[model samples]
Target: MMGRTIFIDPGRCIGCQACVSACRECDSHRGKSMIHLDYPDEGRSVASLPTVCMHCEDPVAPCAEVCPADAILVTPDGVVQQADTTRCIGCANCVNACPFGVPKIDLQAKLQMKCNLCYDRTAYGLAPMCATVCPTGALFYGTVEELRAERPGVQVADSFTFGTTTVSTGVAMVVPADKVQWPVPGGLPVVEINGKDVR
Candidate 1:
């Protein structure tokens, strides 16, 4: 099977929040949006970057590694899932361990919540809700070849470096054609968009 995954193109984002709205409609999200948009420069630019679970691959999942409750699950296909509510103890370990800063502690539910790439839909061979509704194709769900064919000038990068630690992820980011590995200054976990960094 050709591997299908989400590819994020920060440059293509229009701050429309369509992806966020679509994420909220997913049944697993329970009416809450797992995706969020980050404005790299709030006062200067209209450019936005959508944040989703990177689903770290190398070193496995840091969130799951630190979970004493073993609540975080990584699918065979390598998607790092949200905490299992029944097993989660609301410890916030996963939230703190995630380098991408994707996990959130739901106050009311007392559970860690994050994007699972809409596994419920992807498992059935459907595009994720966010990708389906993105007008600009900023969030795309497809094979690597498809992405490369569509955007030949962009580099599909899945490896990021934070100080001395490097992480490989299931999801990829579309960056400048010349760049491949993303390096975070001062070991901070932030995504870069058009040369500006944001979390």
Candidate 2:
């Protein structure tokens, strides 16, 4: 199954809430609003980047492991998905479980919420609304394999931040061969170096 991940560059994000508005407008979501505009900082009102469910590929996903209600599941493509609210008791165990803090609670439905990566839109052969609406060409959408093939030598700041990530986050980001800041943690890691997978 194609994971249908949404990729965004924080440095590149223009802080447009188009993705947020589109998710609500699409209206496939039955229980809760799927996406939200997020801010990395609170003091100065900086360019808050858009963040949603990461859909991690790890076998021991934090959300699924911690959910008392088993509200979250990992798809083959590594997308984290929320379970049906009918089975959900609104305990918020999953909400606390995410290290990245992606899940949101729907005050009206009294259920937890996160993005499904616009399964409906992709099904109809359209780009994710936010990626489409990005005026700065910051946010990107594609397969992990595809991204790796395109960019190399970039490093993840978070992987280094947390002891060692088991390829913890699989989504690959591109930094120009002559760029300033790396995407995730620091610089982009080369998925393949010299036409060979880095060991």
What are the lDDT figures for the candidates, one per model? 0.84, 0.58
- Candidate 2 TM-score over all chains jointly: 0.68
Could you tell me which 10 consecutive residues in candidate 1 have the lowest summed lDDT? 181-190
lDDT of 1 by residue, 4-115 (tens): 9999888889999999999998878768899979896888999898988888898799999999999998889898888998999898998888887788897677888899
* 65: Cα error in model 1, Å: 0.7
Q: Return the lDDT, model 1, position 10.
A: 86
Q: Which regions of candidate 1 are displaced past 4 Å? A: 181-199
For residue 26, what is the lDDT in candidate 2?
Answer: 51
